[model samples]
Target chain A: MSVSLDPVNIADKLSLIDELWTQRKIAGLNDYEIKLAKLKGEFVWHTHPETDELFVVVSGRLTIRLREGDVVLGPGELYVVPRGVEHCPVAEEETAVMLVEPVGTLNTGDTGGPMTRAAEPL
Target chain B: MSVSLDPVNIADKLSLIDELWTQRKIAGLNDYEIKLAKLKGEFVWHTHPETDELFVVVSGRLTIRLREGDVVLGPGELYVVPRGVEHCPVAEEETAVMLVEPVGTLNTGDTGGPMTRAAEPL
Candidate 1:
């Protein structure tokens, strides 16, 4: 599908989420995938040992808790979680975020838990 | 630098552009790079033989002209120009965009001209 004609409205997509946190794949560029994720509360601490993950805040606030320090992001701000770094994401309220990573990446990375779920393609 | 604390603001970065079209690299993701660009007119036609280009519109509008047709994008919209596909970008008005591509991919792709320039890291 052509993304230009139907640009994914992040708010519209996030509003349909039934779970506390959910990820929806919006577009795929060869080996890379762009996803929209709605997050609330806290996620399981995890690390992607093979690939970096790019997170762009679309709305609300998000924080990546690391052992060294915490990274907080606001709308229009982006952060890249380096590979092999342990991090946990937390959202005080409903938040919308954009994620860029490899096509087959898992949400929980090297760790898995109840938060682990396959991404739904938009 | 950590991306979380210094999250790149798409609007703030684009507002400082002095050229008709300029790209600024905000962060690197292993082999990929995230860039912000401000466009106000037509750019040279080009094609990347080895990598697809992902373009996400942050504000205003942008059109990617291809031999098959034209792909137009607006705020929050995204499009991926497949590798080796001849294309040209044109912005009727001032527009802010985010680009995701390989680390060393050139703006003009296989073709080179006055439009070719090095990307400034943010």
Candidate 2:
């Protein structure tokens, strides 16, 4: 199978679901992976011990709950969750976001319950 | 100097310029930096030898020209330039884009002409 070299349109390629958040890999670099997620409801509080995670809101609003305070992100807005910083992302309505993290990063960092899943490449 | 931990709005934070492409740093992580750029016209041919570069178009269109082919990206679209690959980015009109790369990575890779600039932190 020949791999086609094409630019990934995150909004058009998002794997949207109703109940839980869905993640689809847009591209993989040397050590990093770019993934797009459609999110609703709340995700588990987790922390990446090894690397920082970047969340860029593509559309809609996403609130990242932290111990210190809550960070709300809108479209074109981004926040970096420092390594080992516990964060739970919550969205009142449907939101689309692009995530940048190192390869092999677990979706649910420390807590891997029912929501933990291996990302699927788009 | 107190650094505020707030989300950065790429669309709102973009430092638009009339001439050559303009880039401004949005945030910095452990090993990577997020930058927002407003571009129009052609950029010099360059290559990053050590790390791959990511380009996520926030709005408008951007075309990355390579020796073999060209990749055209639209809003919400992304493309990764592999390490050591020579590429030239050109935008016919004003375009807003977000870039991800390792810290200390030069804007102009192998070739540093007039456009070689040290990124200014936002």
Candidate 3:
């Protein structure tokens, strides 16, 4: 099996990303994948029917809009959107985030639309 | 299923920990767990035969010693120790780190010792 010995610099990899709402794969942990993304504006409401999604804010601010309420996160903060929970992400300003989820999970979840983009290696 | 709506502030959760080399479970992603730990000394060499382990340095420096070479990481840097790889972690100074691995994975891996501690929720 091939193994990566090189360390991944989260900030450095994020610096290479220019598009908002696009995720770049950084590493893999078993059946899951770790990704980095730059996000801004509002994203479509979605839900992963089979897996939970983790969002860790790296810079700026991110607001996860749930039907119940809104969860705001800053740098060094993280929140997990439970499986089958409908939620939309909104960023008033540019935000950098790290995401952890199953390898084949989609960004738009069951509500997939035009915002869906496959995460590629950085 | 209970879903945590509150955002977990990594720095805040880390501030509650006082013991070095002890892991505190911060969150859960599917069957895997997200943990936070503080380190300042050498850890025992061990290997997980069934899973990969991810180490993300939140502050200070971390060195992962492998048979091939040592992978050093600073803040905002991360490294993954592939399955069945013998490795040891060392920190010269106080360092805060985030670890992601399978739920039942132990701190000491296959080589259990006095240094091994069960990760408790924060």
Best by lDDT: 3
Model 1: how far residue B100 lies from native, Å: 0.3
Docking class of 3: high
Candidates ranked, most accurate by TM-score first = 3, 1, 2
Q: Tens digits of per-residue lDDT for model 1 on B69-97?
A: 78888888888888888989999998888
Residue B89 of model 3: what lDDT? 96
- Please provide, for model 2 over B1-122, each residue's C-alpha lDDT reduced to its tens digit, 9 standing for 90 to 100: 23246887776677443334656778876688988788888999998998888998877789999887899999878899888888899999888888899888888988988898877776
Candidate 2 lDDT by residue in tens digits, A1-122: 22235987676777443335766777987788888888888899988888888999878899998777789999878999888888899999888888888887888988888888777877
Root-mean-square deviation per candidate: 2.4, 2.5, 1.1
User: Is 1 or 2 the stronger prediction by DockQ?
Assistant: 2
Model 2 error, position A86 (Å): 1.2
Instruction: Give the alpha-carbon lDDT of every model.
Output: 0.84, 0.82, 0.93
- Which residue pairs show collisions in model 1? none
lDDT of 1 by residue, A1-122 (tens): 33233445556666676666667887887798888888889999999999999999988899998877888899998899989889899999888899999988899998988878888886
lDDT of 1 at B8: 67
Chain A TM per prediction: 0.90, 0.90, 0.96
Each model's fnat? 0.61, 0.79, 0.85
